[model samples]
Target: MADNADRAGEIIENRLEGMLGAIALPPRTFAEPICVDCDGEIPAARRQAAPWCVTCAPCQSIRERGSRR
Candidate 1:
């Protein structure tokens, strides 16, 4: 039973590696983050979490909510 589980794990790992290799991930780009709407300083945490962010978290949330219409 243990041997079977080990083999299954190996198969899954190999498949995952192949899948990852098949995709071409985009290169990350960093921008100077500033809240366009509020002209407030965007936190480093938010910028690191979303490198392409143009606004602070609160502004972004509001923008997303407004777009749901």
Candidate 2:
């Protein structure tokens, strides 16, 4: 019974480590003030929210959806 409990705890710890590694954030770099796709204005609010955003909101959404597939 004690061995089984230790094994379960180890499995849970491994799973937690895997999840944390998967969700770890990548290093971000600065983006330009203009939208690269449509040449639209990138709002200051958006720039503040996502400093690494290169495209505008619409383009970013499309790109994200595409990447999901």
Candidate 3:
């Protein structure tokens, strides 16, 4: 049988999980130097500017434009 402490812990854990799910976090893995879509090398300047970036400027621009539709 579950005790009161266990029930409280489960409630807290559930709430925490819900809160974490609502947050938008960056990927935990390292970003590759190459763009995933165009197979072009991501610029060193861009990489330095945005370490979490996964696409080059052109590919990213296209993706953004497509997303607006």
The candidate that wins on lDDT is 3
Give the TM-score (vs. native) of candidate 2. Answer: 0.52
Candidate 2 lDDT by residue in tens digits, 1-69: 579889999999999999998995634645678999899988888887787788999988989999999
Q: Choose 2 or 3, whichever is better by lDDT.
A: 3
Model 3: per-residue lDDT, tens digit, 1-69? 999999999999999999999999775555688999999999888887787999999999999999999
Model 2 scores what on Cα lDDT? 0.85
TM agreement with the true structure for every prediction: 0.57, 0.52, 0.56
Q: Write the per-residue lDDT of candidate 1 for residues 1-69, one digit (tens) a residue.
A: 579889999999999999999997644665466788899989988777777788988998999999998
Report how far residue 57 has shifted in candidate 1, in Å: 0.4
lDDT of each: 0.84, 0.85, 0.90
- Of 1 and 2, the candidate ahead on lDDT is 2
* Model 3 lowest lDDT segment of ten: 24-33
